[model samples]
Target: MSVVNPGDTVPSAKVVVSDHVSFEQFVVSRSRALLRTAYLLTQDRHLAEDLVQTSLAKWWAARRRVTGDPEPYVRRIMVNEFASGWRRRWRGERPTAEPPDTHGPAIEPHTDLWAALANLPRRQRAVIVLRFFDDLTEADTAKTLGVSVGTVKSQTARALATLRIDPLLKAD
Candidate 1:
């Protein structure tokens, strides 16, 4: 049998540890921003949390292969996850006809904008979130969504047009 090379194996083991540390640091630094972006995409706090966790888990699994700024990679994962309509396997909570009462004052100031955003089609919504909320350029948004820049521009234009005319925003 051929002998194993210690030099070849040892460095790779160190690299794995280094990569793990980098990934951990990335998660610590970016989790909040990621959660905010996810919240905008999902429009529900619980769903946003779930989206961030799922995207991070998927990113962690492929961490070694990723290079440069991990934010874009993580963001791309979030966008893709949101677009594909990721849902929980077991939705234990059932919706009630009547809304539950809350004790605290309303925190979100831009409820009308959120409502308008919620009404947008998924692709247009993704474009709006990535371009406006995340502040990505047309080229960058296109790269993240794996679409052409023209598609990003067109979607952005269409979403904005729809939002401008939305009755929810008009009421405000």
Candidate 2:
């Protein structure tokens, strides 16, 4: 039997059967990519992990009803979750005068672009991330966001316009 590694991409030819094993395989193969997309959407690593976990839990609960490729459905869930403002309250830690010590290298290289992206309204930011970062077609982006294709187009246009004039981006 062929072995499937966690990092391996799920084969497109293999149909997703409505079974827990299939779902587990799908999660193992796709979670990293989903985490990356979540990071782009939420702009915070911890939030991104929570977002992915939340989306996956939702998808798992509805797995029996899910058909065809599950990626889009999970993506829709992530976008919806991000847009719904269901965030955990910051009760454990409070900001202090001095930053915490760090020895690890920086995680993000495109701080300027990310900062500019953070400035965008949620919908516009979603459109930009779905269309460009995820390389989804405008129609696919619309379907993921549960909006019209025209809405996706307009949002993308507005986001690009804003990015073009962002001071951080313009400084480069």
Q: Which has the greatest lDDT?
A: 2
Candidate 2 per-residue lDDT, tens place, 31-107, comes to 89999999998888877887887888789788778887888899899987776454522333333421223223433
Clashing pairs in 1: none
The local distance difference test score of each candidate is 0.75, 0.76
Over 4 Å off, model 2: 1-21, 88-109
Error of 1 at 120 (Å): 0.6
Question: What is the per-residue lDDT of model 1 for residues 35-99, given as tens digits with 9 covering 90 to 100?
Answer: 99988888888778878878877787887788767778888998887775565223433334212
Candidate 1 root-mean-square deviation in Å = 10.1
Worst 10 residues of 2 by lDDT: 95-104
User: What's the TM-score of every candidate structure?
Assistant: 0.75, 0.75
